[model samples]
Target: MAISKHIIITSLFISLLLLHPLVQAIDQEMTSNNRGGSSFAPKMNCGVACEARCRLSSRQNLCKRACGTCCSRCNCVPPGTSGNQELCPCYYTMTTHGGRRKCP
Candidate 1:
């Protein structure tokens, strides 16, 4: 019983040791990615951005919801109510579950 318990602890320790380098690599990559600025992204004012994005929509509420979702994820919105997707690639590439374009 003691030997089995020792073996279990030894196995656990080895597993953690193997995982340590992988965890460190991920941490280093994230740290380097953020070295240019804050580690946490500044939150977007989705309400105002979305409001502007949706201002000219015929379906205002639906437009706001879609614009808000894209703004939240991309932290950006193209400057107008229409067709300037080149400004935000993340927002431009997003799609709905059914493969329809997601961002307004």
Candidate 2:
């Protein structure tokens, strides 16, 4: 049992060491991609963006409420009242407390 435990620890250490460079590269790429998540996207008017996004929703108020929250956080709103989440990865990934997609 001790030998197996030792082997496991050694393997885990080796794995993390080998993966360190890969982790650093990923971190660097993401940092560059969003500049540490500060002002990376162009300044946008959340009111206008959410208005456009929620314009066609049957439940306009709820749509705008959720869209407003998403816009403030992601600094983006998908064009139109429907799909196009690809334009904003952050918005695409936003979720509610219930784990459902939040943006309209």
Candidate 3:
């Protein structure tokens, strides 16, 4: 009976570890190609940790400023530019729809 109980506990522990979202979140975060660099963390910059993860608001001055600096390093096209603005969505859509193609 004790052996069975220990096996149950061990299996439950391993199952919970596998189920934890943090595992995947951390993996995704580490692999992120965001070019703000490893120096900037959304956690440290957000003032407090958010219960759920979210992207920084593009409307915020900080995000806009950061994006202006960082977007060139990312695969994304700049949000506003003459002529290219219209093409940006199609580019993004195709890229997303196909899944992780090399940036132009």
* TM-score, every prediction: 0.64, 0.61, 0.23
Order of the predicted models by lDDT, top scorer first: 1, 2, 3
Model 3, 44-92: lDDT tens digits are 3221211111134434554344333333343344333222433445333
Better of 1 and 3 by lDDT: 1
lDDT of all predictions: 0.90, 0.89, 0.44
Task: Answer with 1 or 2, whichever has the higher TM-score.
Answer: 1
C-alpha lDDT (0 to 100) for residue 54 of candidate 3 = 16
In candidate 3, position 67 carries an lDDT of: 36
lDDT of 2 by residue, 1-104 (tens): 99999999999999999999999999989888886557565778999988888888899999999999988888888887799998999999988889999888
After aligning candidate 2 to the native by TM-score, how far in Å is the CA of 5 from where it should be? 64
In model 3, which range of ten residues has the least summed lDDT? 45-54
Q: How far is candidate 3 from the true structure (C-alpha RMSD, Å)?
A: 14.0
